[model samples]
Target: MFVARSIAADHKDLIHDVSYDFHGRRMATCSSDQSIKVWDKGDNGEWNCTASWKTHSGSVWRVTWAHPEFGQVLASCSFDRTAIVWEEIVGESNDKQRGQSHWIKRTTLVDSRTSVTDVKFAPKHMGLMLTTCSADGVVRIYEAPDVMNLSQWSLQHEISSKLSCSCISWNPSSSRAHAPMIAVGSDDSNVTYGGKVQIYEYNEVTRKYAKAETLMTVTDAVHDIAFAPNLGRSFHVLAIATKDVRIFKLVPLRKDSSSSAPTKFEVQVLAQFDSHNSQVWRVSWNITSTILASSGDDGCVRLWKANYMDNWKCTGILKGDGSPVYGSSGQPGALSGVLGSAAAQSALNGATGR
Candidate 1:
């Protein structure tokens, strides 16, 4: 069974993005009101606001958390045409109150010519790396030279795309035998570009990122894309949010021993869902990548799962009225809600009463 539990997270304006930490115990939210707030889940299964501060001079578009091994770090991109890295200082005396953790600005990446649309921390195995995309159609990757130092970062690579890049996700699997890979999505609605989704692979010999593949079927503007966390699967699964929710499977080809040509791969559409009648804005996979949760303009969040036969199906849907509608198969449902509303209410009430 599924039930909606709303906790108030008062924010002054529209909340643009929310990101949970690797452990899923902490969350960070950014808003158009130029502020960011942090929440921690308590032992009682409730969430409380721990910190809130004015973060940027303009609307903050996205906030993402680095792996916990990096010490509670966060990255946010904004309409101010810059991205900021924040670090949480533990056991520090707050200016207004004693014995509170203080979040300090670590470094500001100011390279984008237009509004920064997205920011993401690279997988932990990649070691202290961050990537950002902007309305200028450029993607920049930055790295902390020293893992212990959060204040200094160096621009490692910059790639310019033909369309406005909206979001990116790093392939979490790190096999020393294979090159690093990342998936990028653009917000371009033009069909002439072939597709809004593209994959880039890092070439060790050339020391550059090269285009691996383009998903030609996704013609609509892509709001977000995520490469699922791989377990032991031989192939990779990618979830995309266009006008609808689309899933694709990427199978890598074995390198030919006799030939010197670079390795190749194939991408096939696995499923396309029309459950959300409007545009889907976000798609997130659980840690196991066994299920996917998507939210859209319909004011609802839908959960999709695959059966043993590899057939994908909608398992549950959470409506705006806080009701769960199960699929015909009678599988158990999952919880979903409007995270922004809770933040807005909390912001207005000036207390954690909700």
Candidate 2:
């Protein structure tokens, strides 16, 4: 059954994003109040606030954690037209006395002229890299030349989409047969612009990223995009949040080994859903990429799963802190507990003062 668990996020304004660490034991939340808070899960399964501080002068849009291999590091982008990297430091005597953690700003990226909407850390297999997309229709990739020196980052590549970008996801495939790739989504309102999703692949010969494919069927403004965790699969799965939730399957087409051209994909739309009745704000997949979760303006999180025949269906519908609105008879429903839910009941309560 679906259940309600009060997180008491304690942000002064609406929370925009919530991100769990690689281990799923730690989390960070960013809010419109221009602050970010880190939470640590206790042995009793309760999340305790370990650090809270102002992260930007403007509303923070997204916050993400780096691979645990890089230590405790976080990256955040905001409406302030900049992105900042933060590192957690413990045992400062005063902090140690209180048994608290402290996060310091390691670097700030100010390349975008418009608000930075999304920030993400690349897959661990890609080394220590960061990507940021802004409303100015630009995507920038940065790398820390030295893992030990967190204060310095070099802007490696910049790609212009010619459409306002709202979100991005890096293909997590670690197989040698696949190349490093990224998908960028746009929130541009002009319907005249054909498609909103673009896929780019790293060209080893050219030593740069090249446009491989454009999802022409996705004509709507995309709010969030995520690539399913690759588990030795030859094809890739992508979930996009827009007016509706959509799933796309990208099968890599075979190419000549001597070809320097980017690999092409046989793109197919697996599923499209409008059960939310409004814009879907976020989409996330389980670690295994079997179950998908989407939240929207209708105030419900719907879980999707595929059957043995690869037919995708909604297995459950859960409201914010309430009894079961609906559920599948045998489907594993509770959603990894409450740690991954970003749109907590606080938003519903805050709007009506209930």
Candidate 3:
């Protein structure tokens, strides 16, 4: 059996989100430390810190990288009532030979009333849309600047929900011919009473986006959701982490059934493994879409893999020496820093001695 490799360390507080770049060459993580650090692969097969930035005044809750279409642009959300954008710049030959980078601050967006909870970019290239959810129970879309300028993002429209949104994910399977679509999950009260996973479709003729339908509701709150990564073909699955981690095979149709009520989409439960004792915080898929990783308030990271029968089984667990991920306790940042540093060192040292 192949062993699980330690990729990076934990945060000082709970790690709210983890995301990979389009090429899967880099990873970005955000935590309660109020900072976002970008990790890249080194020649020795080790992960090294490429860049770091303190983007949020309060704890950063979520982060996502822009699609290849956007050229390394990053978006992060925080409890500080704002979301900030970050970009990476490759230094010129002379500057690179001297081992230095010319980093720049492209833009920063602020929301006065609501604390931004999550942020996501459209999946395709040359895409100019961005979606953000806030504590004000509103989801807003903005048109990214044509160039690198971020002085102002034109607000497209805002969709209001009964409760604040906790998470959001854009469908990666839709092609250019079809209208864009996004899925969102809200708090438990909203999940049980209001529509849980609401799908929004962009209408070009109306120049507006309308709620097409609701997916499925759960008994507990929905915290995080992720679209499956495409190996060679487009991703046709979505995994949701909340009170439970659920995998759904998305069946995209050429013509969307026009219905106003919540229709339970034919979702196949690939696997449902209860590895975490507490509420799961985040879930991610590798480029292959075969393996899944989940983190929880229980302070453990569990790895799940699909078997021959297409059944998902818990294969590994990463424990944190007994720490609480939710409350004011637990040192998620320092521990993660040390562990990440150690992991990098180990990879550099190779399969030999430490």
Candidate 4:
């Protein structure tokens, strides 16, 4: 279930992406208007725009936030073939009140010859690392040699893909036992070459990234992909948005003592849903990874959950400004077809983390 909340009509073009901060108290939205806006949640549970500025010359594709420990840092990628890192600095005020925070450009990554589609910061334990995917069919990882300095970055590794890359997600867990993992999705509509979704793992022995698995079942162009937050589960869960919403369970292979082979992983489809009826553009998982929110071209956002028996079903749906339109899988006490306001509020509260 979802309630209607509107941002001011400041953007001149379509908004491309929205991302929440690590604590869910703030959100950043980017648009084709070449601008970005930051919103903060108030004590009354309403979101208010705090800052809005133009950050790029071309259309901004995506915006991502670093961990709060990094002191209010953000990264944005644009169609200008460059990615910029911005840091927030508190301004000096003559009055006895605190002044507004000013954002300054720290670094510009200009390695991509084409448009940069996505940018993601590595986990906090990785020490100021970032990964960017481009329309040039390349994925580059950059690291800051010193965490205190934000302007200097060293390109660590570059991997070439067969098709244009659209989005990427990094595994958030910092377990040293398992190699760092990332998932990349391709937006190429051509089906002849079979470029859809690929997973890469950091090979510590070779000091580079290697392709670990390719999802063959997803033949269509993938719009977004996300790896769920691991909660001591034996297998990892991944969600992909294409023409439909597909969930997969990834299992890591055990180390072989006899042959000394490298570690590998296998993926199996856990569930698929076509309720959107159109191209699904975005998919996001809650903090617990129990519920998933999906937005599509159908102008609706739907929430899905799995029962105790592992059967996935639609829990709630939200259309335009009206109340949440419950489906047949709604709770037992809910109305046969429609859910009451109290029930919808309770359901939506559980879906969103604070």
Among the numbered candidates, top lDDT falls to: 2
Clashing residue pairs in candidate 4 (N, C-alpha, C atoms within 3 angstroms): none
Name the lDDT of candidate 4: 0.78
Error of 1 at 217 (Å): 1.1
lDDT by residue (tens digit), candidate 3, 69-107 = 667788888888887776667863353434334345666
Per-residue accuracy of model 4 over 36-133 as CA lDDT, tens digit each: 88878799878777777899999998899999888899999999999999987776434323423467789999999999999999988888899999
Model 1, position 81, has a per-residue lDDT of 94
How far out, in Å, is residue 55 in model 2? 1.0
Candidate 1 clashing pairs, residues 3+ apart or interchain = 9-342, 9-343, 10-343, 10-346, 10-347, 11-343
**lDDT (tens digit, per residue) of candidate 2 on 189-263:** 887777899999998888888899999888888988999988999999999988999999999999986688999
Whole-structure CA lDDT of model 1:
0.79
Which 10 successive residues of model 1 have the least lDDT summed?
345-354
TM-score leaderboard ranking: 2, 1, 4, 3
In each prediction, how many residue pairs overlap at the backbone (N, C-alpha, C within less than 3 A)? 6, 0, 6, 0
The residue ranges of model 4 lying beyond 4 angstroms of the native Cα positions read 92-99, 256-262, 328-354
Q: Where does candidate 2 clash, by residue pair? A: none
- Stronger candidate by lDDT (1 vs 2): 2
Model 3, residue 305: C-alpha shift (Å): 4.3
Quick one: best TM-score, which candidate?
2
Candidate 1, residues 1-354, lDDT tens digits: the string is 444556666889878787877766787888888999998878987888888899999998889999889898999999999999999987665464543457899999999999899999998989999999988888899999897999889999998877899889898877654567888898876866667888887876667787878888888888878888888677789999888999999998887434434346688888999778888878888777877777777777777788999899876667655566655677536443322332222122211100
Cα displacement (angstroms), candidate 2, residue 41, comes to 1.1
TM-score of each: 0.90, 0.92, 0.75, 0.88
- Report, for every candidate in turn, its global Cα lDDT versus the true structure: 0.79, 0.84, 0.63, 0.78
